[model samples]
Target chain A: MVGSALNQIEIRRLVKAFGNRAVLKGVDLTVAEGEFLTLVGPNGAGKTTLMNVISTLTKPTGGLVRVAGYDLADGAVAVRRQIGLVSHKTLLYDDLSAEQNLRFYARMYDVPNVEARIETVLRRVGLWGRQRDPVRTYSRGMQQRLAIARAMLHDPPILLLDEPDTGLDQHAAAMLTDLLHEVGATRRTVLMTTHNLDRGLELGDRVAILAGGRIAYQAAKSELDAEQFREVYYQYVKQRV
Target chain B: MPLIMPYLRKVFAIVAKDVVAELRTREMLSSMFVFSLLVILIFNFAFDLRAENQKTLAPGVLWVAIAFAGMLGLSRSFIMEKDRGSIEGLLLTPVDRSAIYLGKMLGNVLFISVVEIVILPIFVVLFNLSARDLPLLVGVMILGTIGFAGVGTLFSAMVIHTRAREVLLPILLFPVVIPVMLSAVKLTAAILDRLPFADVQNWFSLLVAFDAIFMALSFILFDYVMEE
Candidate 1:
């Protein structure tokens, strides 16, 4: 199983420390190819830090991280080519239209057939009609949707999302949920972190909770429903604190 | 040629995006143009001019204007990216990190050159200078701006995340480029005085050397600085 086709991400004893304070302490986790793993963690649990590490946006203080069969330290550019990250920031230029923004990233990633891909992704996000409008004019939901389209431009097989559904209303949240499910169904490996436990359990094939910079509790999602997972999460975090 | 073409395209892509953004606002260029005129106007009024001494002081005045105005453009190059939250997105691209440095450096150089081009005629009119060596003066100005833009681009990236970056960037940048500034001022003086090219060759070579050294160091060290 170590080098099997199913293995997309493997982390062993990951540690990230800023000065004397350690934020992620010897965290170990693995996500199989085409599996959707949702990580639920309390505030300050280092979830974002771990996502940054996997995307190679942040380097680790120590330990091993390998994504898409390449080591993190020596293979950053290679790793970047294989993953797309959606963080809190939309990462879109406010002045550039959605089409221009996608075109810019498509060129950066050297994505072939750039125009067609931009159109397809814009259509998928339900923003094709407004492609020429500056992203500044976009509503929060529309901008978030454009952000997702930007990530999908390069079409990397590994997707890392950090709190992607943080600020959406119910209608937009439902749209995002549908999009996430479609993305997961397309045989891509996904690792997501969220505070919404109900959505996390519903979407994840496996659920992992991080506390005190470590994996506090992890199990198959089918083994615990939303109510049981809440009890487990609170009790586990309370004991650790 | 084919192998290097893609990298060149990426470099130009970044510059194009920046150019498009700047055109939409015209903020950086307008500020630099206005500030350049203000500096020369202030110096023109403040100084008691002897026509003979004006030739002597012309180089210092020209470079001082260019350097100060160019610093504003350079700081805005990366600061705008950081402010709009696009720097991280730029960083995650698959190309070498040095490509981003080169692209920003090129954008900074382009903005400086544009402002300097506009300011040159104003400079000549205000200082009452003749056109004996205008071509040579433009040549030296280009060289001087390259070194200025290179060092400024490096430091602007370093200070992008810091507080009061407006105050911090100049403080960090001014001391480091003193050599380039001195060489540039000397070259400008030599050209304005219409001294034989041989007299200023040393300064010209030194400016080129400074530019080359700074560009190499900035490109080599930027990858390490960008990685967090």
Candidate 2:
């Protein structure tokens, strides 16, 4: 996991501090190409901060971070071209219809064959039937699914999701799980931060626990038992708390 | 660098999307139109706007209405994006960041200009400006609105994430846009008074120069401001 396959993300001694407080202090993590890595962390554990850095939304204070083989410092525009981000919020205009939102993004991303791509993503997210409806009228689950479609429209090699399941109900959460399953099969490198331990661990090929502004533990999903993982999770969290 | 056509096309796409959104709800436009009308009505009654007062006071009053109404629209430009969290999505797009500013400024200009167009004829009757000045008035309005909207759009976006943005926008905007308003008011007054172009050419130059400066500054600063 450290350096074998084509690495999509390589972060070494990454530091992000706001004023006097450092949210991420010297973090190092690597995600292989096409790997599904779920990072479970508590609030203020720097999980979102790392995702922001990778997405080029936040500039790192120190250390090196490479996404899709582009350095985070100088290659932001290039990195942006190679990644798509889905945050907790839907980020779609409420008044715009689903079709309009997708098409708007499609044009902004300069996607060719815009009509075809919008249709493809809309259908994939099961929103094509209601594509003409305003996004304001959509349910939370539907919006999240449409967000998935939106993030995938440009077909970037890497995807970054931050607390996407925060506001979803059980049914919607299950739908998201299924959607992620289908998405993971495409061999896109995904780095998702989640609080839902059960579901998070279930979907990831590898799981990492982040606490105390750093990744405390990481292992392949098959290598750790569920009960043992719970013990290890709390053990790391207890020390940090 | 990316192709210029694609860059320009993205700017238009943002404008179209905003126009469609505004048309659906009429949120910003309706408020702006009504507000502009209210300002005019208040001035009509407040000042004893007789024939003598109409020349100086009316031009000032008309500009006051347009500037405040434009502010009403500009204040919401980025507020909508902030509320819906769409600003982040816009920034995440691969297009040039300046294109976003241009697109948003275009929408604001369109919105403010619409309000101006609706109120101008009414302004003529209320203030007794002859219809002969209509052509010149239209030109002045375009130049004035561009400068106003350019500065307003930038300041509004700058304060979008501030806690007191609703209160902050006018306070931050009015001072910076005072130069624009001054030139516009002087230009409109010159036209109404039947002054020679020589008297107003300086004002027109100032208006265009302010607009060009503001547009360029906003274009360069938008990317930095948008960074979280």
The candidate scoring highest on lDDT is 2
lDDT of 2 by residue, A1-241 (tens): 1223488999999999988999999899999999999999888899989988888878899999988888877777778888988889888998999999999989888788999999999899899899999999999999999999999999999989898898999999999999998889998999999998887788888999999998899999999877887888889999998
Which has the greatest DockQ?
A: 1
lDDT score of residue B147 within candidate 1: 92
lDDT of 1 by residue, A48-86 (tens): 999989988789999999899888888888888898888
**DockQ (Cα-based) per candidate?**
0.79, 0.73
Candidate 2 wrong stretches, greater than 4 Å: A1-5
What residue pairs clash in candidate 2, if any at all?
Answer: none
Question: lDDT (0-100) at residue A39 of candidate 1?
Answer: 96
Q: List native contact recovery per candidate, as a fraction of 1.
A: 0.75, 0.75
**Model 2 lDDT on a 0 to 1 scale:** 0.89
TM-score of each: 0.97, 0.97
Positional deviation of residue A80's Cα in model 1 after best superposition, in angstroms: 0.7
For candidate 1, lDDT tens digit of each residue in B1-228? 225788888898999999988887898999999998999999998898689789888788888999899889988888888898888889888888888898999999999999988989989888888876689889888888899999999999998878888789999998998988999889888777778889878888889999999999999999877765
